[model samples]
Structures are given as C-alpha cells and as structure tokens.
Target chain A: MQIRDLVRRRTPLGWKQLVHSKGRMAIATAGVAFAVLLIFMQLGFMNMLFESAVMIHRQLNADIVLVSSTSRDFASPGTFPRSRLLQAVGVPGVADAEALYVTPRDWIKQSETNRGERAQMLMIGVRPDFAAFRDPEIAAQLPLLVETGTALFDRKTRGNFIPFRQAIERGERPQTELGGRTVTLVGTMQIGSSFGSEGVLIVSDQTFFEFALNRVPSAPSVGLVNVAPDHDAAGVAAAIRARFGTYDDTMVMTMEDFIEHSKGRMRRDSAISFVFTFGTIIGMIVGVVIVLEILSADVHDHLAEYATFKAMGFSNRALLGVVFEQSLILSVAGFVPGLLVSLGLYAVVRSALTMPIAMTVERLVLVFGLAVTMCALSGALAMRRVRKADPADVF
Target chain B: MELSRLSHWYGAGETRRQVLFELDLVIPRGEVVFLMGPSGCGKTTILTLVGGLRSVQQGSVRVAGRELAGANEARLIANRRQCGFIFQAHNLHRSLTARENVRMGLEAQGRGLPPDADERSERMLAVVGLADHANKFQHQLSGGQRQRVAIARALVAEPPLILADEPTAALDRQTGHDVVALLRRVARERGMTVLMVTHDNRVLDFADRLLEMEDGRIVAARPGAAAAAPVNP
Candidate 1:
C-alpha cells in the first residue's frame, strides 16, 4: 500500500493514548532523556581521552617523524641516535631534519608563601632556529629559548600555576628550578596538557643536556623531517624506512601515522576507554528498561481498548505499530533535552580539564542513532504484550 | 448466516468443560434475532462463534458464504471485517471523541478512510440520536449516550452482520428500549442481519424472532411481539 494510504487508515492512536495522560508522558520523556544524557557524556569522555593522548603529536610541525623502535608512546619513548637525522637529510625529497629531546623533570615551585612544592613536568629541547612546532605564537617566541638556562612554559597546563602565569603575563621573568638547576621562564607557549604530563617546558638543546644529567647529547628522542615542496611525505617516509630496515633501531612514519600510533597505544593500554564504553552500554540498558516499563504499563491500562480494536478487525501488526509509534515519539522528545544538557556539561569538562572535547556532528548523529535503537528495542519487547490482546475476551 | 452442529469447550484434558453442544441455527438476511437465556446457557458463546471471535471446534459455521470452522488468523480477521460487534461494557476508547470512535469502525477494515468518512460517522451518530455529542469523549458522555455511541460505531461501516452482547444491560429502562428500537429501525433500513444476546425482557418487542436456550440447547423458537399475528387467530 502507498504510505499516504496507510497513514490515512491510522487515527493517531499512539499520540492520543500518550497525551491522554499528561503526567505519564512527562515521566517517560524525562526517563529517556536521562539515559540519553548519560550515553552522550560517556561517549564524550571516551573521545576526549584519546584526543588528549595525542595532543602533542598533532601539534608537531613535520610531514614525517622518526622514533626509536622500542618506544611505546609519548610517556616512555626511547631515544634514537642523532646520526639517523643527519642521514635522513641526504634522501632525495628530504628537507632539513631537526632533533627533539624529551624528558620528564621535577619542577620546584619555590614561592614565598608556599614552601618548595614539587610538580612533575615534561621538558622538550629544540634548536632555536628550527623549532618543530606548528603554532605561530610558539614559533615567534622560540628566539627567547636560544639563551641557556631559559625556558618557555605551557600556558594551558593543568595544575595550580596561577601565580607563575600571572608573573609571566606581567612581563616579569619568573625563576623556577628544574631537576635541581635554576632556570628562568622567558616566555609562554600554548600547547595544552595531556594525561601523561600536566605541563610542558621548552628549553634550548644545550640547556636540555644540562638539565638531563643522565642523557648523552648524541641521542635524541624524536627526529622531525619536513618534506621539500612539491614532494609527497609518504614517498620520503618510505625511502627513510627503506634506509632504516628491520635491523636498524629507528622507526619511520608519516606525521599522521605517528599521531595514530600514539592514540592506538593509549587505547590498547588504558582501561579508561573500556570503562567509558561500558558506561555507554549501561546507559542504553537503562533506557530500554525505562521505555519497557512505560509501554508495558500503558498496554495494561488499555488492554480492553486494544481487544476492542482487534475485535473490529485490526491486525496484530497494526496494533503493534501504535506502540512503536509511541516509542519513537519518546525518543525524539527526549533527545533534544539530553543533547542540550550534554553540550553544557561538555563545556564544563573542557574548561576543567583543559582538554579538546567538543560536540561534533558525527558524535551527535551517533548518539541519536543509539537513542533510537534503544527505544526500538523496547518497542519490540512490549509488542509481546500487545499480541496477547484476545478479541474473544472482549465479548 | 448458518451454524450446523457447532460445539465448543473450555480448558484442556481433564479440566475441560463443554459450553456449546452441537447447536444448529440459521439466520436469514435482514432479520433481527434475539437469543435469550439465563446465565451460562451458552447464548453469548453462540454470538461469539457467529461473529468469528471464537473458532468452531466441532462443526461448521458459515457467515456471508465463508466457512469459519477452521479459519486461520488472517481469514478470521477478514471474516470479522464483515461483522460489527457491540459489547456489554460499550468498550469505547476513552482517548477518542464520539465521532472519532465511530470512525474507527470504518478504519478497521484495513482500507484507507473513505473520502467522506466524517460525514458518514456523523450521519450514523445522528441516526442514533447522538449527533450533538459527537465531539465529546467517552468520559464526558452519560451511560446511555455512550451506548448510543457504541451503536453508531457498530453501524457506521454498514457491515452485513452485527452481533451485540447485552448492549443495553447498563442503561435505564427507557434508554434500553430506545436503543433497541433504534438498532431495529437501522437494521431494517440497511437490510443488515443482527444476532443479539440479552437478558433484558423490556427490549424483546424489538426482535423479529426469539430463540430461548437452556443447557446449551435451543428449547423454544417463536415470533417476537413485533411479528404479525397468525391468520387463524
């Protein structure tokens, strides 16, 4: 039958039934909205967790990257020889390669009011002329790092640094000790913090060796390679990989792959992702239970009316359609408030964690899809009760 | 409509108890028949079987030339579309208005609504003296008015057969008489067959034929008060 004809045969039975009891409708809508809100928050946290893990890798200004084969992730990346970067520069479409030294150090926050408190911070050492960072603000301030014993602090760091950041904004160079050596904060960069480190400190390559007393200068943590214009980074990366075969200690990959690798490691090693996914499933289950309760009660209330419909020659499928329609209405009515509240909560979480968590179109569609599926499943289960309506009993 | 040696039972195995015992009856077109009996005499069971609400377990039931003895669910549903049913409780959907409740009868046939379905429903309501209460929900209407609405709903689709079970059981004396008189007049005007089961003696004059039952058997058959007198008398 044509859809219009099918619709014409229906008398808005589901809508009439729902609106007949205003209080029940409100309760059902609220219940579904609560479940949808829970699912959205869990999904949001899960995506942000992975995003924060690769925040630094995404900010690096390089077409290709080289790391030690033994490196697991950013938190514990092993070092590779500096000679590999020099060898990489000789490849056909290769631009200049820069060495980046990374190490975690304790910063002694020695303020007059608070006795020396220790905070673990990430330290990145780079060349003053060729700092491999994508942000223009950080690149412009790289000249300040040319002086030894000078560092640029990350402005988006996660701990309590209000006084230290205020001092930098006031144009007063703040003095802090890193790994027991005194250093001055010359400027501030805007690389946000990740789960591995609460803050980042950028220093000159000479100062990096001075502060990292156990590390040698000949080895670097990562090699950043830029491709010459009009050449493909993937091709250069393939050549670099061929140069450093399985026997070599270095691993070559495009910058995009490097970021994905970091995220993959985080996903495989962290239990937080599994927790968030479980939370989403739990939300869906709660939604199913709520919808089932509402629908079952509705069917029980109107059992005689449903039997009368059956006695009047209405098929079982048509009767089931009425219940399904109610479910779909609840899903749509509830999703709007859930999405609105989730957006508000997302803003709060982003500000509190300094993480890159925002509502995307894909996530919105995904959560809405999930909500519909949850309600539909409840509708299917409630149909069993509808099928039990016996026309014989109505007489 | 015809029923030949139809038997029905409730429950299974050792708990089984017979309700209808090889009953035989035939109703012609455009006739209004009443089946009257005390409680548990199987009057309502006969009405249910003829209406295709219950399966005929022992014998044959033919309504509108279709056999309903061993019909499947789909066939039974199709047979039900040819008949209208009125229950003891009126059974009006509280969510729908009087006119909308009447319109449901036409929609139940699985055909899209006719272009003039509203006019038909309103006209049916007017015939039953309920035109003014078309927009009122079931709760807003009195007991007698709800029964009239049920009658309108049963007749709006113009089915060939109607089966009513104590349609006036809940109404007052005058209301019950009026309801049956209206049903009789409409059945005669439309040439529709009706089989009603009732214990109310006040409405017996509206029937053309009356069958009295006892112990699942038809004990007597006679002309009702509305029938013409015998020539020899």
Candidate 2:
C-alpha cells in the first residue's frame, strides 16, 4: 500500500475510540482544557511579571545611559556628578547628553474627591526638549511640561485617588500635590505602575529642583545619552565606560544592557517571578494527573479489545500507537477551548489589572508544546495497562 | 497446525500447576477439526499455543510452517498473521463498526491490503449473515450478530488457519447451528484449516473430525481418527 493509504487506514481507530462515548469524550476534553487554561494563566502572569518589570527600562529614549556605580534600577539609582554627563558629550558616537533626576516623592490626594490618600510616587525630572521617555505620547506631551511646577501624569497608572487619566480624557488639567508642593497635571503619558512604585510622574528639571527639598542642582541620579545615527551605541557606551572607569563613582551602559540588568535583578530578587514559576509547574502537574487518570481509565475500559487485537496479530507498537493518538487528540481538542478561554481571560486581566499581560506567539507555542508533552507523558505511563493485556487472560 | 508433547503449566516454584499434559495433535490443511473437552481440560491453552497467543513452554508448536518455541515477538506476530481467531466472547472492539472490525483483520496482516478491502469486508459480512449490520457497533448488535461479526473479522483476511474457542457458545441452538454451518461452508470453500475448542455437543456434527479431551488428555478419537493411548507427562 502507498504510505498515504497506510496512514489513512490506521488513523481513524484512535478517533473512533475517543468518540465512542460522547459524554466521556466531553469530560476528557474539558479536563484537558482546564489543564491548558491553568498553564496559560500561570505563564501569562510570568510573562506579565517579566514585561512589567522592564517597562520603565524599555521606554527610555536614550541608547546609552550613565548612572552612579552604586545604582540598582530606575527607581533606585544613586546620585552622579552632572559633569560625568558633560564628559560623555565629546565621546565618539555621543549625540546628546541630558540629566534625569529620579526620586520618590510623597503625594497627598485632595479630600474633596472623598479620600485623602497619600502615596509615594517615582518622580522623573527631565528637560522638555530632551525628554527621557521613549513613547511618542509622552514625547508629544513633554513640551507641555516645560511650564514651571507642571508635570505629565502616567495615564496608565492604577488607582482613583486623583483620576489622572479621567481628568485628561475630560480635557481638564488637574492640580496635584507632590512633596507638599502643588503641581499641575498638564498632560498625560502611558507608562503604567510597576512593582516598585505605586505611580509615576514626569516634570521639568527646573520644577524638579524647586520641589526636591535640600537637593543640589549639580548632582543628578542618571544621565541619558543618545547615540548618533550610523554610530554604534555599544561603542559609545564602551567609550563612556572607559572614560568613567577611573572616576569610581559612575557606570555607563547601553539601554539594552541596562534593561537586561533590571530584568536579571527582578528575576533573582522578586517573589513575583517565584510565584509564577511555581504556579506554572503546578499547572503542568495538574495537567499530567488529569490526563493520566483519563487515559488510564480508557486503557482499563479497552483491555479486552486490546487483548483481542494482540491475539489477532496486532503488534504492541500498533496498539500503543492508538493510545498515543488518543492522547494527541485530547491535547489538541482541549487546547482549542482552553486557548479561546485564555484569550478572553487575558482581555479581562489586561482591563482589570491595568498590567502588561498579553499573549505572545512564543508563549502560545510554548504552552501548546507543553500540553502535548504533558498528554504524551500520561499516555506513555498509561501504557502499562496495555502491556498487561494478555490474550490468554482474555480467552 | 501441529502440537507435539505440549506440556504446559502456570506459575512458578511451589505455586506451579500443570494445565496441559503430553498433548499431541495435528490437523492437515483445509480440515475442520474440533477438540471437545470439559472445563479445565487445557483446550483453550492448546488453542492459544497453536495460535501463537501464548509462548510454547515445554513442547513444540508449529502453525503455518513456523515453529513457535522460543520464537521472538516479531516471529510470533508474523506467525499469528497466518491465522484468524474467533472467540466465545465475540471479542470485537466495541468502538468499531462491524465493517471496521472486519477491516482490522486485514489490517493486522501488515501487508498492503487490496484496493477493494472494504468490498472484501462487506462480502465477508454478507457471508456471515451480517451484511445489514455492517455499520453497527458491537453494543448495537445482538449476541448472534456480534458472533457473526467476529466470524467475519476472523475470515476476512482469508488466513490459512482459523483458531476458534467456542465460537457458537453464546448463540441460541438454531443460531449456533447456523453459525457452525457457516464456518464449515466458508472453511471448505476457501480451503482453510480450522481448529475449534468447544464443550457444546450441539455443534459437533459440523466438524470433519472430533477429538474428546479429558483432564488435559485426548481420551477418545473416532470417525477418521488416528487413535493413540493417553500419554502421561
């Protein structure tokens, strides 16, 4: 027989077995879908955690950045000399250098809105023309923050203490208190809240200096360094690093390197990653257990039939092929409903949590592959019953 | 099909118990031979050994020109393909239709089936008086119809040897007679050898030869029989 005909003839046995009991098949498919949903949710949270951890780092406009050697992350940068940024100006591949003042500032929401909530927000101060934020919406709003004592509120920030996004949507400029000083929310940007900060605000450097109590104008937390087009950013970062290697006070790195640095820190230090990792493993285990139970029952139910096949000259390999095929069917059948449900769940999560949860091609392929592996493993483990199907016993 | 000094036992050490003792049987090509015995007489054991369903433990078992003693799994499978099987339980896969069950027999040959494999299944089902029930599952068929499906599945591949363990035991007397007649007719027409183990006296007339077994021994042989004294193991 041709290969196609051989394949075609042998392929329907598994499907026929699965569909023999419609209720059982439905239950089995539902069980598999539950497994897939669990895997998707856990992995989705992991993806969100990783993506959200690097949100600020990904949005930096500069190709290279200069920070204190003691700096940890965006919200934890130590102070560096402003002259270090100036020293970087003449380096090869350096396009421009601008200071970024980052500090946590306490904000008090007005009681007129029914709650006098106080929160510490990460305040980023930069010049209007050389804004450090990379998003076009924020860049477009930078010119509006040039006015003294005015700032662009992160529209994606959660919490209703000030209605930041709502006010902007209503075409109203709401004034808010930062560090016990009044500041106007003149425009809005789209950097959402992170694990380290409850909210984020951007302001002009002049207003930052005025509102920052006892802070010197000569020192800044970080220096944003843009690389010239046609010049390598890493080379410029290397040049800056070499120039500052002797200073013992500052570190220079490309934006990509800094983002990795932040992500590495989050992965090693945060419980968010740990929880998601554990959840994903648990999901896989649950999936394996459910499939094992279903496949085991299936094998048990069909023991006599398998024995008859053996007596009729069917190879053990061919019989096991039927089980494996059933597993693949269950995996794929359950995965479709699970994926559809997960997509809907993702939308709900994105809307409710205002986090960076999303479905990616890599993640879809990964979970699907894991699901198949999970079911295949269960099928293999369940083949013990198939092996025990003795034709002598059947007779 | 042949069996020589086929002494068989179960378990090991102190739990060991013998089943078949010094069993010697032979059936020539195209002959319908029936081995009639009471319960616990090792009739099924001998059938399984000859069908390559069980390993030969203490004797020689040759069927379709291949010796089964110490045969590897591949060799055993190859030998089994040359024989067809029907059982008292009507061991048809409940999930498959009668037609599909019959096709499974041809598929078991592992050789390329003819393009008219479906037609062959249909024709075989018709021969078994199950043509109208071809698309029915085992659960949907009556006991007799299920047995008929088993018959079709066994004979569909046109195997040289057919091993049946009480093929008509589950059917009514008339149905049993019809099934046995059908089996005899098909075997004679196809020049197929048959070895059936049965305790049912009602179907004895269908066999071309009969051997009566008692306590794992062939105690009586008559009507074209080669008589031999019962040998102890």
Candidate 3:
C-alpha cells in the first residue's frame, strides 16, 4: 500500500481507538486544549497591548515631532517660542503648522465624586480645521472647534473610559466656564487610543490656555512642524534641522520616528507582551507534559500490538509514522475546540470590557501551525520508546 | 537449518548459569521434526537459537544457507520473515479483528492483501476450523480458538518453515492432540518443514520423526536416522 494510504487508514483506527476508550482520549485532548488555549490567550493579550500602543501614534499624523533633546519622551517637556510655529509653516513644502500640547491631568472618578486619579491628557489647540484630539473620521465638523469658548474630550483616556455610567447617573460631569463663556459639552468620542485609558480634552488655543492651568509660561509653545505631501518626511526634518541648527539640543523626530519612539516607550513597559509570553510559555510546558503523558499511556496500553507489528516485519519507521499520526490527530482535535473557546472569550471581553482583542489571520494561522508542530515534536519524542522496542523485548 | 556448537546463559556476567550447552544439529527442508524434553532442559534455548531470536555467541546457525551466528541485522530479519512462529500464548492485536490479525502477517511480506483479504482470511480460518469465529477478537475466543488463529497467522505468510513452541501447552489433552494433528496434516499438505517443541509425549504420534533433547542437546533421533544423514538439500 502507499504510505499515505496506510497513514490515512491507520490514524482513523487511532480515532476508533480513542472512541472505544473515551476517558483516555479525553485526558489526551485536555492536554492539547490547554496548550492551544494558552497560545490564544497570549495572542489576545499581545494584540490588546500592541494595538493600544500603536493606536496612540497612528491617529496623530504629524510630519515631525520636535522635542527637547534633554526631554526623555512625550511624558516630559521641551518648550520653544510660539514664533517657531510661523517659521515651520513658511518652509518650501509645508502644508500647515499647528501648536500641539500634552501633559498629565486629574480625572475625577466616575463612581465617586470626591476622589480623582492622575491621568495623562493630550491637549491639542484646534486651529480652524485640526481634529488632533479626535479622529477626523469621528468628528463631523472640525471647523466648529474654532469658536471662542468650546472644547472636545477624547473619551478613551487613562481610567476615564467614556461610557462612564456612574458619572451620567450622578447628573454632573464637571461643567465649567472657559474664555469668558460657558463651554458646552456638545458631544464625546474616542481619539483612537492613548498610552493609558485616561481621557483627553480639546479646545480652541485661546480657551485651552485660559481654562487649563498646566500650559507652561516658562517657554511659550512646545514645538512646531509641517505636514508635507511630496517631500520625504526625513527631508522635511532635515530642512527643519537647517532652520533650527540643533539649537538648545533640539531633536527633530520625523513622523515615522515619532511613531517609532512612542512604540519603543510603550514596549519598554509592555504589560501585554508580558501576558502573551506568560501564556505561551505556560502553553509549551503544559503541552509537552500532556503530549508526553498521553503518548506514554497509549504506547503502554498497546504494547503487545506494537510488538506484534514489529515481529510481523514492519520497520521502526512505519511504527513511528503510525504513532506520530495519532499525536497529530489528538492535537488537531483538541485545538479546534480550544480555538473556538479562545475566540469566544476574545469577542466577549472586547465588547464587554472595552479592551481590544485582535484576531489577525496571520497570527491565527501562526498559532495553529505552532500548535500542530508542538504536538508532532513532543509526540515523536514521547514515542521514541516504540522505535527502540524489540519484538523479543516487548513480547 | 544447521546448528553448530551453540550455547546460551542467563543472568548477569558473574552469576550466569549456562542453559544451552555446545550442541550441533541439522534440520532439512520438507522435514517435520519434533523435539521433546522436560521443562528447563533448554528446549526453548535451542528453538530460540534456530529462530534467530537469541544472539548466537558460541557457534553458528544457518537457515536457508544464510549464516545466523555472524549474520548482520538485515540478513537476520530477512531470515525471520521466511519463518513462521507459533507460540503457546496467542500474540494478537486485540483492537483488530481475527481477519486483520491474519492479514497483518500477509502485510509483513511487503504485500497488501487484495480487496478480498477478508475472504482469503476466512479461507485460512476455515482451514484451521475457525471460520465461524473469524470476526471475533482474540479475547472473545477460547484458548483453543485463539491458538487456531495464531496457527492461521503463522500459515498466512506462506513461510517456508514453521516453528511451534509448546503450541498446545494451555489446552486440554484432546484439543492439544487435535492441534498437533492439524500441524502435521498442514506440513504434509503444504510442503512446510515443521519443528515443534513439545513436553507432551501424547502428541508425538503425529510426528514423522522425533528427536529427543536433553541437557540443551539433541541426544538421539529415530532408529532409522543414519540413512537420512545427508542433512541438507
């Protein structure tokens, strides 16, 4: 018979064997299920963490983020004169220039009125049509923010997730005056993402500076740059470098570089990658043990059958193929259900907890491939006893 | 087949006790011989040596003119395929039906049984008087039936030689003699050279020639043996 047919015919015998001994198959499947589940959990945690990190930077489309070289990252400060904004707009390939502001703030707890927690907020001064604090797609009319006393809030800031039921129930969500007029809470939505789940507020440059006390007067503005169409971001950065000539150790990070910088910052303390690694490591260890145990039991229970096969002149290679096929079948069987469970959990948590759980085809395929490979490898190692078995030995 | 000065010992190096002494003998094709001995007289050792199941140390054994003493692994395996072995205990894959067990032997000959493997297995089972029990597992069969299945397994490969080690040791006297008679009849009908190890002298009536074994050596043959002394084909 062709080897493939033998494997095909023989492994279903493995399934029959499993069915006849339901308890044994269940034990075997449990091992595989847990291993698959582990990999899924890892992917879930990683997606949530990585997507959240990149989302923060992906939503901001600045050409360059000029920060003080002495500043560690967005968490710290580098300030320059507001005149630098005019100089940035005058560059040859420049489209528009705007001053961006960022700093930490206190977000009053939604559940409790008396206590509030520290939350980092990105305070952008809306310049006629800039929806820097909210995704452009979500905002209906960006030009409306140019009014004298108005502000928009990014709902998905640090502990300040927007569906704050408690605050809505209390009938008070911090109404205050700004720029000599009542700044109304027209509407609210997410600005894609942030380093934390805290909230952010946007207003006109006049209203924001007048209302929020954190705006630095030590130096007028943070930094400025233009968004260009045809020119490479690096080229624009270079021109900005020539214009400023590294005065006060200024660091001109291109849009890509800024995104890369934010990613690095998030990665340094990435809780999601940690959770993912934790899951994968646990999965591998658990998978090895389960596969080893299940394989050992099947071989032991069928010692005489394997001995008969050997005595009947089937080579060790043939025996190994049969056993390896059995392992793969068990791995695949358990993985199907395990993956379904993981996907269900991800969907539930994504909608219910307001946290992201990314399910990419590439990652799903990778984890599936890994699950199969892990089973085959560990199963083969466990079945080494069969290959070493002597007909005379087993008999 | 020939054996020359072969011996085996059991236990560890220093504590070892010899089982088979240095012995010399020859078995020929188309010959049905029976060896009778008491327990622990090393009848098993001699059979194991001839079967290529033991490591040949002191001397040589040759089956179908292939040297067994210094034979490499490949040659020994090939020799084993040409011989069919029936032991006292039935060694069958319990998960497989009686037919699959028999077909497994046929499979070992590098032949996939035809689509009619089941029909062919039924024929072999009928030859051993087990056609009615052909679909049952070994555990479902009586001791006599299981032994019949094992005999069917031995013959299914169409081996040139057949060896039975106490083939009926677990059965009643009548069943034991019946199996012995069946073995003799198959040997004569199919031209199989058979060597059976038995402690039961009652089964000796079916042997064409009886060789008495004592102290790991075949001490005597039938009274008219010298004239049959060519020893090889």
Candidate 4:
C-alpha cells in the first residue's frame, strides 16, 4: 500500500487516548523529560572531562612528541636525556627538534592585594627561538622570554590572580617569586587550565636551570619534533620509535596519538569517567521504569475499552500498534524540552569552569537514539498487559 | 445461524460446573430473536458463543456459513468481523465522538478504516436518529442517546448478524422501547439477523420470536406479538 493511503486509513487511536486526560499527559511528559535531562547532563559532563584533559595537547606546535616511557600523564613529567632531541634531528623527514623542560613549582603571589599567597603552577622552559605553541599570540611573546627572569603567564589559570593579571594588562611588569627567586611576568598566554594543572608559567631555558636547582641541564621533560613539508608525521614517528626500540627510557608518538593516549589514560585511571557513565545508565533505567509505569497505568485504565476492540475483531498486533505509537509520541515530546535545558546548562558550566564543554551533532543524535530505544523497551514490557485483554470479558 | 448440541463448562476438572447444556436452535436470516431467562440460565453464554467472542467447546456453532467449532484465533477473529455486538452498558469509548465510535465498527474488520468511513458512520447515526449528536462524546450524550450510538456502531459495518446482550437494560422504560424499536427497524431495513438477550419485558414485543430458557435448556419457543403483522421493512 502507498504510505499516504496507509496513513489515511489508520485511526490515530493512541493520540486520542493520550490527549483524553490532560493532567495525565502532562505528568507523563514531565517524567520522561526529567530522565532525558539527567542523561544529557551526565553525557555532557563526561565529554567535557575528556575535552579538558587534551586542551594543551591540541595547542602544541609539534607534529610528533616524545615523552619519558615512565610518564603516566602531563602531571608526571619523567625526564629523558636532551641528546635524544639532538639525535631526532638527524633522522629523515625531521625538520627541527626542541627540548621542553616541565615541572610543578610554588609561585608566591606578589600582588599588593594578595602578597605571599603561594599557588602550585606548571612551569614550561623552552629555547627562546623555538616555536613551542600553535597559538600565534603565544608565539609572538616568545622573543620576550630571551631575557633572564622574564616569563609569560597563562591568563586562563584557575586560582585568584586578578591583581597580577591586571598588572600585566596595564603593561607594568609584575614580579612573582618562583622557587624563592623573583621572576618578571612579561606577557600572557591563553592556554586554559585543566584538572592536572591550575596555572602555567613559561620561561627561557637559561632561567629554568636557575630556579630548578635539583634538575640537570642535560635532562628535559619532553622532546618536540616538527616533520618537514611533504613528510607524514606518522611515518617519522614510526622511524623514531624504531631508532629508540631498545631504549626503555622514552616513548615516541604522533601528536594525534599522544592526545588520544592522554584521554585514554584519564578514562582508564579516573573514577570521574566511571561515575558519569554510571549516571547515564541510571538515567536510562529511570526513564524505562517511568515510561513502563505510565503505559501500564494507561492500559489498566482502559482495559474494558481494549476488550471492546478485541470483540470488534482487532487482533493483538493491531492493539499493540496503539501502545507503540504512544511511546513514540512520548519520546519526541519529552526530548525537545530536555535538549533545550541541557544546552542552557552546558553554557553555564562552560563559562563557570572555563572548561571545553559544548554540544556536538554526534552527541545530539546519540542521545536521541538512546531516548527512542528506552521508550521502545518500555513499550515492549507494557504490551504484555495489552495482550491480556479478553474479548469475552467485555460481556 | 445455527447451534446444535452446544454445551459449555466453567473452571477446571476439580471445580467444573456446566453452564450450557446440549441445546439446539436455529435463527433464520433477517429474523429478530430475543433470548429471555432468569439470571444464571446461560442467556449471555449463547450470545457470546454465537458472536465468536468465546470458543465453542462442544458441538457446532455455524454463523454466516462458517463453523466456529475448533476454529483458530485468526479464523474466529475473521468470523467476528461478519457480526456486530452490543453490550449491557453502551460500551462506547469515551475518548471518541459518537461518529468516531460508530466508525470503529468498520475499522475493526481487521482492515484499515474505509475511505468513506465518515460518511458511512454519519449515515448510520442518521438512521438511528442520532445525526445531531454525531460529534458529541459519550459523556455528552444522555443514557438513551449513548445506547442509540451503540446501536449505530453495531450496525454501521452492515454485518450479516448482530448479537446484543442486555442492550437496553440500562435505559429507562420509554428510552428502552425507542432503542429496541430503532434496532428492529435498522436490522429489518438492512436484512440482518439479530439475537438479543434481555430481561426487559417492555421491549419483548419488538422481537419476531422469543426463546425462553431455564437451567441451560430452552423451555419454550413461540412467535412474538409482532410476528403476525410484519413491520414496514
């Protein structure tokens, strides 16, 4: 049969039944919407966690990155020999290689408003001439780091640094104590904060050795390699891995793989990912139960009517169509409000925490698919009651 | 319609009790027959069996040239489509209007709604003197009007037979008489056979034949008051 003819012939019995009682429809819609909202929130937070963890990796200028094999994540910066970077430059397709020294150090806030307030911040030391960041604004400020005691500050840092930031904004160099030595903040970079580090400070390699007393100059935390034009970064990374195959002290990977590895580590080692995933499953369960209750009650309320339909020659499958239609209607009706509310909540969280949380088309489609599946499951369970309607009972 | 040696029981082996004894009866086409008896005399059981609402346990129930004995669920449903049914209370769906309720009769034939179902339902409602109340819900209609709508629904599909159980039992005296008269007129006009079960004596005169039952057996059968003079068909 043609689609139009089929639709014209079928009575919208489910719609009429649902709209018969306005109060019940409203309650049912609200119940489904609440569950949808819960699922959206959990999924949104989980994506944000992964996005925040890889914010810095996405901004790095290197096509390939080399890290210590013992390093678990950005927080655990196990050092390797600086000579590894020198050796990497001799390999085919290697354009340039640079050494990056990273460590967490106590920064004594030296603003008149909050003097001597110490905060732990990540410090990155690099050669002044090397392009260390993909952000052009940070790259432009690299030349200022050529002077000793000069450093760049991350403006998106998490803690209270309003006074220090304002001082830099006014073009006045603000002096802050790092490792008990005063350093001048010459510029600001916009690399946002993550769960691992609340703030970042960048200085030249010469000043890095003066502040890090326990570290040797020959050992750097990371090796950055830029592939020459027309050379694939993955191939170069593979060659680097082959060159260091027997050496267990360092690991090499393409930048894309490095970002994924970081995200995978967070997902595997952090309880937050599990908590959010569990919450999402719980939301789906709650949705199924609520829809089942609504549909079961609707069937119970109209059992006699269903029996009358049976007596009139309706088959069990025909009766089930009515219920499944109701479930589809509820899923669509509830999903709209749930999605709108979630968007607003995502905005609130994005601004409040400076976190990389935003809506994507994939997430929207996934959640909608989940909502439909949840309602369909409930419809199947509720159909058991509809099949019990006996035609003879109507008499 | 014919019923031969029909017998039925309720419950399992331990608590079994016979409800219908071995009975024999035949209802010719276009005849309006009423089955009357005291309570617990199998009046409704006969209607259920003849309507294909219940399985015929023992003996044969043949309606519209189809045997219902040992019929599968699908076959029984097909048989039901050829018949109409009315209940004691006007079991109209409250969610639908009078016209929509009537249309359900045609829609329930295991086919989708017919293309001209609206006009057919409206015409059927007009036949039953309910044209003005076609758009009104069951709750909006009075008790007599609801019963009339039920009659419209039962006959809208133009079934070959109609089986009603206490169709006018919930209506008042005058309303009950008008409803039965309407039913008789419509059934006669359509050349449809009807088997109604009722205890109301006021509406008994509309039937062409009356079968009186006692203890699951037909005690007496005779022509009704209307049998001698046929109504204008």
C-alpha lDDT values of all predictions: 0.88, 0.84, 0.68, 0.88
For each candidate in turn, give its C-alpha RMSD to the true structure in angstroms: 2.7, 4.1, 5.1, 2.5
Residue-level error in angstroms, candidate 2, position A142? 3.7
Question: What is the per-residue lDDT of model 4 for residues A93-164, given as tens digits with 9 covering 90 to 100?
Answer: 999999888888888865455678887778888898999889999889999998898899998887566777
Point out where model 4 deviates above 4 Å: A106-119, A175-183, B231-233
Report the alpha-carbon TM-score of model 3 versus the true structure.
Answer: 0.82
Model 2 misplaced regions, further than 4 Å: A1-3, A110-114, A135-137, A140-148, A161-176, B111-115, B224-233
DockQ of each: 0.73, 0.57, 0.34, 0.82
Per-residue C-alpha lDDT of model 2 across residues A12-82, encoded as one tens digit per residue: 77789889877777887898898889989998987787777678878888898888888878888889999
Q: Tell me the tens digit of each residue's lDDT in model 1 across B57-116.
A: 998999999999899989999988899898999999999999999999998988757767
lDDT of 3 at B174: 91
Q: How accurately is candidate 1 docked according to DockQ?
A: 0.73
- Write down the DockQ of candidate 4: 0.82
Q: What digit string (tens of lDDT, one per residue) describes model 4 on residues B177-219?
A: 9999889888988899999999999998888999999999999
Error of 3 at A52 (Å): 1.1
Candidate with the greatest DockQ versus the true structure: 4
Q: Considering only the true interface residues, what is the Cα RMSD of candidate 2 after superposition? A: 1.8
Give the per-residue Cα lDDT of candidate 2 at A38.
92
